[model samples]
Target: MLAVSRSVTRARIAARLPIVERTTAGRPTPTRTTKERTMPQHPKGSVLEFDLRGTGSGVLQEVAIAGSEHAVRAEGHPAFGGTDSAPSPLDLVLSAYVSCNQVTATIVALGQGITLGAFEGRVQAELDNSVLVFGAEGDGTFQRLTLTVDLETELDDAAFDAFVAEVARRCPLTQLFERAGVEITNAWTNRALARV
Candidate 1:
């Protein structure tokens, strides 16, 4: 089970917002009867935890959130002589960066009063494994990270650029990459011709 240390009650969170349901046509429609929604309010400065135990040997491990029963397996890269049964830790980190960008960018855009229509993205990272695997002196970090996003919105070109700039500034993963001196690139596509 995943144990989240909630400083606020669930009722308080539920009281803050009405339940919204997606219709068959994929439009968000508010329901007449409000329901207690999971993750209704975002908790700030919350301490998150993850617990993991080695499954057997060979650098394979099973991980679980403290209050959650679900677990996932992780393993070392096959290039390091271990069976590639699951994603490596580095792979997970890369995935986290990608997922974080998507979530943060969308939330920020919505907060900026931009009605989001559709959003899709792809992330790619280039890494040099020689440092970690071959005992090289240099860093074993990502040399470059790139994000390509297709956004369906009515914002004009200037407004779209501004939105993307704000997203890049606000995204934690983007800042992390910047702080770590990693080269990051972003490409965006507007799906709608109408301007706002």
Candidate 2:
């Protein structure tokens, strides 16, 4: 297991960012991590922080978390879009895939002593009934997310393919999807029912 880094500080906090405010009351808001690990989702009122350190290959849309709107602002750069307010959950999912691949690639390449240059990943997912139904066939409720990735790297084809598989194995999103066998947790206050 890689010694993952949890090195974010309050100084690294984008206090003005709306998403930061959404993290108020200790809620984990949605965002990517520095090495690009998308932390598991938390219940409402949590802070989700991601440290983005991807090379400016211009794949991701530039966004900013400025001044307490309680969510990250989609500053959408010229490549993706411009001046959009925020990214939808779907958009974030795609980002999560990208980040996951990047992190996975880094660890896999370094471990194998492979020189990696220009890593890029594109993910395509479908929000349809088939995948969901497949996952929910039994007495479990589940959501299905599938990604088709196009990876560009410098390693040999065989090594790169292995690297991709390795990364996918360790990628947080893939792990959650593969290991999460739908078991919903529902809790609520008990109330007395009056006899009528």
Candidate 3:
């Protein structure tokens, strides 16, 4: 596990940057704790915030969160006239979905007394780019999402099946896709694979 913290304070907002505001009325966002043998407890509610500054070329942008010393660059896809130096926003979305599933699965495994050898998830999506790129008249979104997970463990088939079922049901990313009307195909391989 990894500890994640955030503080809501004034960040340096340079001139000419467009800022989006989201208001929440509740407790401060909870900090995530890591390195414990058990999974971290979930917060009832949390407030997340972030900022992005355009890089002034090819739809590129630099992203950061409050209190973070590092930032990541994002850019539009090359097909849309971007330089393709960094990942497109849609790429980030798919990556986040897979990454979130990996973390959530690990936590579920730890809680279920399952000793995991290795695990990996790959996510891919098909998008209807006409709306964003060619000015089509329908909603621009993913037409389908495919998630494949390779997992290694010593548990019996029944136990592994149960574990996978629980993880699939509890993974927040899966629910997000469902809520967004994106069709998802989930495949699991309960065997070892080359580790990256």
By summed lDDT, the worst window of 10 consecutive residues in model 1 runs over: 1-10
lDDT per model vs. reference: 0.69, 0.47, 0.68
Off by over 4 Å in 1: 1-56, 193-196
lDDT of 3 at 120: 73
Error of 3 at 76 (Å): 0.5
Off by over 4 Å in 3: 1-58, 192-196
TM-score of each: 0.68, 0.42, 0.68
- Give a tens-digit lDDT track for model 2, residues 77-158: 3334433455643567668766776776565665566544444355554444344335544334234454544444444566
Model 3 agreement with the true structure over 1-196: per-residue lDDT tens digits: 2211122112321222343343348444333324422342554323333544444454888777445466778888898767889898888888988888776766676556555666677987899899988999986878899999887776677877788778778788788788878898888778742344
Best by lDDT: 1
Relative to the true structure, candidate 2 has a C-alpha RMSD (angstroms) of: 18.6
Model 3 per-residue lDDT at 40 = 29
